[model samples]
Target: MKQDQKPSVVLITGGSSGIGKSIGTFLAAKGFTVYGTSRNPSKFENFEPFPLLQLDVADTYSIEAAVAIIEKQHGRLDILINNAGAGIMGAVEEVPNDEILKNFTTNYFGPIEVTKAVLPLMRKQKQGLIINITSIAGYMGLPYRGIYSASKAALEITTEAWRMELKPFNIEMTNVAPGDFATNIAAGRYHAPVRKGSPYATSYQNILSLIDNHVDDGNDPQEMAKAVYKIIQTKKPKIHYKVGQFMQKFSIVLKRILPDKVYERLLMNHYKIK
Candidate 1:
């Protein structure tokens, strides 16, 4: 950020589209050397804002190769944004075990593996920042989005412990829990079918539509980009940062003060679950 200083090099997973793409583009505009990862870079031939490397977060070999490329080109990786994740929706009883595992693979384990790959570089540098992009849904379980909530909540809590561990290395770690943003996540989310005559059919179908509508009406991803930029400029970043609409953020505060059943009732009422 200083005139004589070298620009910071940044690596963002899941950067090919959605929130990741927005962050890369924003930081690139601000003079950060940015690289974004996609499972398949060849498919995004028109991607021009930043280079997209072929790296599937779920694959360790792919992650190592991508980090290697960044280290080769820049010689120092300064910031790692673990933004790669997927969404899953279903009734707890109806969603198959495999689907739940698949969601955790992408939304939970994927970020951890990516963080592990980048830590060596950051440790060597002796100064770095790792921002984990999580979700506000992580704070509380939404009726039909329990799996998605659990995956994000896992990352949210994991970052807290990791932040303390990384303190001695001067490598900062934080979680950014964002509320719904207008993106392709809804289309990509794995949804368990609402089978006819199944006990959860009507409720699940109704909640699914509500979930999609929330995403469709969500805020811009650029808001998240700005939040990330702010965190990067801070002298000492906190363990957690949240970006979203007022009520969405307030819900987290309410949960802290309200009784357990009261909070549960609030959520059930919001989702119209009897």
Candidate 2:
């Protein structure tokens, strides 16, 4: 390796657009060998300056292949950001079993599988950082976006466990809990089996409007990317970091101290359900 060369390599999933793309681009500009992934890479090749790998986080074979490509090409992976995830919005009872499974497959299990695939390389290197992009909702379940919250919450718990377990290997893990950002994430939200005359229709519609407005007026994806860049540079990064609007990020702390009913009312008020 050259004396002044950028030797670090980073692999980010779901990096075709939005938050993932922003992080990949930001890190690449800083001289890291960044590889962004999507289920389809050629579609985004012209749009992005850096390399984009074809990866479907939900598929085991695709994940294994993507990691193999990165390891074979770079010979080392310094960072792995599990930023591939999607949201699902539907009443708990109304959401079909398969729909819930699909949501978890993408949001929860995908990261786990990707991390498992990359651990060997990081382990061989004996030092690496794995940052999972959970959500502010992971700390507290949202009104209509319950499954999204649940999946993120599951990821959060798993991250904590992995962090402790990976310490001996010098493999670090962190959870980045982001609030609604100005991205195309809403377009990918799964609103499955939502019936017109369902009892939760009014609440769902109202909550959806609130969610849209929040995201429309939210922070940029670059903000998240910058925060993550700092995390990458930190020598002792914290186990969890929250990024988003002030209130959204603060809500996590509030949930811990506030009474259950009080917190419930605050959530209802925020969603304008009452």
Candidate 3:
């Protein structure tokens, strides 16, 4: 951000609200040129700080068109924030296959496709950064959130491989896994119905309430925005970064050091599952 230098251009997918919106506003305030994307841009007509572009990560043509517009306007794209995602909650035994696939389409494949669309621009620029917003849940399989966990975990691992491949090009890639944030993710997340007399009905209902409350009391989205800003300023960013509350972030470390069954017991106990 020197006097002679142009502000870096950043594109954040799913930018209309929640964490994406916060990040865009934060970066814009810091003098970075920011553009946020939504599946339907017209709905966010009054969005401030940065303009919203119409981009559905799940649609290849939409992804390409959005990137094309940015390239035309800015001439160079410096950062891509893969933040668009959806959540799914259900028992592995009960969640429909199509629902699982749909979740993956939004949370896993969507980000990957968007990254693919942006890579050529980054490569041509010979310098760029791609930050994939993963989740702390991705580190382990939570009972009702298995699909959501798997989708994020997939992105986390994929980013590791992508980082190595992009090394020679001076382009960088990384994953930032966030824990529960006070976002509207719960409202948007797909939930398999708690069928009457189903074996998991009681426990599933209990955990569902727990999950919503956790999100309701989660950290501010600005915390994530600051973390992203820090990563962008890093000369050689790490393959992975995590942002969340103390115990939430520590949960990953516990999983690494604790016995498998012991960790499972701890998780079940916290969820009040038998």
Candidate 4:
């Protein structure tokens, strides 16, 4: 494709529902050709109206197939949004090693594989944007969400490193750390186990109650879609973005500034698990 003839192409993973769907829909509305990748095409609401490509982030073969299909049609991808991840809710002790692997496979390694496949195309084109839908939990840990938090935290750190590494290649990496947005994350949350002799079983239930209440008042998905659009459109977007409740923004900052012990105690007291 010629320099001026190429159109903006957005390939989003986990685009069938929730935040990923919102981002894909918003991008589509902007006149960008959007391709949503999901494991189940049924999860894709309207492919006729838009476009959906079957993709499974946890599987390398699926990611390759999705990218191959996109490359065949578009030749070059301008935007890659790694939005495929789910929350695994369980105490670290209760959660089995296999479950931990499952969490990271989707949240961390899945994106890594997709990015690897697309990076070559972007490098050849000499321009592209990779947006990661990291969570506020990545910046600040939460009780009874240790696995989910760990996965997101890993993604966050890797995004930072990739940002620098990809900058020299003229590729951009943006990590959007959104505070709790109203989504199916809670409903779809994977509950595995509490480790042997774990004392967190009762405490986990308390955290679930808090989550149930907060999801009711979480930020609208549209707000996040708009934020995503802004990040993608900006010539030089911030490497890290935090959106949602002002209180969350403040708390994340506080954690950064305070001592480790201070933050740990604050979290403990905040959740009343002590």
Candidate No. with top lDDT: 3
Misplaced by over 4 Å in model 1 are 1-4
Question: How well is each residue in 30-83 modelled by candidate 1, as lDDT tens digits?
Answer: 999999999989999999999999999889999999999999998889999999
- In order of appearance, the predictions have TM-scores of 0.98, 0.96, 0.98, 0.93
Residue 240 of model 1 has an lDDT of 86
Model 4, 1-274: lDDT tens digits are 1223555898988887788888888878878888987788975465653587888887788888888888899798999999989878877767778888988999999999999989999999899899998888888678788888888999999988888999988899989988888888777778765445567767787787787677767998888899988887688878789888998888898998999999999999988887
**Model 3 per-residue lDDT tens digits across residues 134-241:** 999999999999999999999999998988999899889999999999999998999999999999999999999999999999999999999999998888899899
The C-alpha local distance difference test score for the whole of candidate 4 amounts to 0.84
Looking at candidate 4, the ten consecutive residues that score lowest on lDDT are 1-10
Worst 10 residues of 3 by lDDT: 1-10
Higher-ranked by lDDT: 2 or 3: 3
lDDT of 2 by residue, 60-159 (tens): 9999998999888878888999999998888888888899999999999999999999999989988899999999989988888888899999999999
User: How much lDDT does candidate 2 score?
Assistant: 0.88
